[model samples]
Target: MWGVFSNFIACEIGFWIVIILGLFTRYVLKKNKLGLFFLALTPVIDLILLIITGVDLYRGATATTAHAIAAVYIGVSIVFGKSMIKWADERFRYYVTKEGPKPIKLYGIEYSKHYLKRWGKHVFSYLIGAGILAGVILLINDSSRTEALLRVLQIWTLALGIDLVISVSYFNWPRKKDD
Candidate 1:
């Protein structure tokens, strides 16, 4: 029983780590896909940890503690995450303005066009990710510890990838007002 509890503790560590690392990564790559994906994953991963830890995911102390921790993780990820990403984004603009070819700079459209292109990319990217996930799930027999590890890795990879795309792509275009 005590051993089972360790899983949750380890998961908590992973969640907090994601929050810290994701924020730091965003500081370097303004719209980094990896950072964004981890940010989005913190909560979901925590929830999964709770379930795997034999905690009654939505009942009693475990639920309360999980929610509290998740709230803190998400809050920090958002506030620090935004500040870092914004600073980095400014740097990116500076870099691109100076280093990227002039033609590319001139070709850069306001975010709307970028968003349109992203939708198509996500469709294919997610399909591939999902396929990989399914293959892993099927290949691993659920009767062993390896299954859990594979599940964790697969979900993290796909979730993080998705978060990365969603997170950074939003920055690609300034939001337009609805007519």
Candidate 2:
């Protein structure tokens, strides 16, 4: 379990390092091909995490919260990774290189709409994570081994519910732009 958690942290740190390096290479060094090569490594990081987690489970390790989180992380990364890179690219171009327009600051209805879109992505991520977790539980076919993963699903479901409420509330009370 601890090994899985450690690997999860390492994967997250590695993902960002690759992203920043990619952006830097693209904008600062002006090497488009190398930058793209770096950016393309993001999926490889996800694959590494998935393989590590799967291997641990296959070795007869009990499914843990860390294992469950690894699944969720992979799902979220797959769904949001492109947008995340784009968002970072825009900011890196604007702030680091002063090459692009300033990133827009969302507020009011736009903010609500953006929040809703992200929440929808969260829904999709949850479905994918839960499906993987369920498949694992069934494959293992041992309630005792998968109890922690089940708890993770229950907790994540509650978190998703809370997120939905907040997302909808943004529409009712749109945020005001800063003075």
Candidate 3:
């Protein structure tokens, strides 16, 4: 049990390190290609951790609650990691570029007359996607009811937090006066 806990902690620590390095290189250093290379490596690391967890299970080690939770967390992270990074990158560039807001195509829509409306739709899409993911996780998870519920809540909270940040940043962004 202690071993499993230690392993989970170590994996999480390593995961964040990879994310920070990738984002910093990609966004801060402007080494887009290299940043992508690092970002793409995250899933491989996740896969390795999953394999370790699986091996322990196969070796007759009874999986504890933490073990199950760790597995679920890694799986979800792998699924959402790239998309999250891309979304953040897009928003970060939008803010830093300081391009005046104007009616423009966003997420395939040809035009949005208002920034709030566009951001609302964007946030709604994220909510729908998160709902689907949570539904899938609930269907697949065989863990304790409490843990599954907690996981779903965590997903919702994270999705909402991210969406809120993006929406707020765009809404509050400085806009040039329309000529």
Model 3: ten consecutive residues of lowest lDDT: 103-112
lDDT string, candidate 2, 1-179, tens digits: 79999999999999999999999999999999999899999999999999999999999999999999998998899899999999999999999999999999999999999999999999999999989999999999999999999999999999999999999999999999999
What root-mean-square deviation over C-alphas does model 1 reach?
12.6
lDDT per residue (tens digit) for residues 30-57 in model 1: 5568877876776576456535533332
Best by TM-score: 2
The clash count for each model shown is: 3, 0, 0
lDDT of 2 at 78: 89
* Per-model C-alpha RMSD: 12.6, 0.9, 8.5
Model 2, position 59: C-alpha lDDT score: 95
- Candidate 1: Cα lDDT at 99: 35
- Taking the tens digit of each residue's C-alpha lDDT, what string does model 3 give over 4-81? 777777777777677667777877787989987877787777777667766665565655655555655564665566
lDDT of 2: 0.95
* C-alpha positional error of residue 93 in candidate 1 after TM-score superposition, expressed in Å: 18
Q: What lDDT score is found at residue 177 in candidate 3? A: 46
Question: TM-score for each prediction?
Answer: 0.30, 0.97, 0.50
Off by over 4 Å in 2: none
- Best-to-worst order by lDDT is 2, 3, 1
**Minimal lDDT window, size 10, model 1:** 58-67
Show the colliding residue pairs in model 1: 33-164, 37-164, 111-173
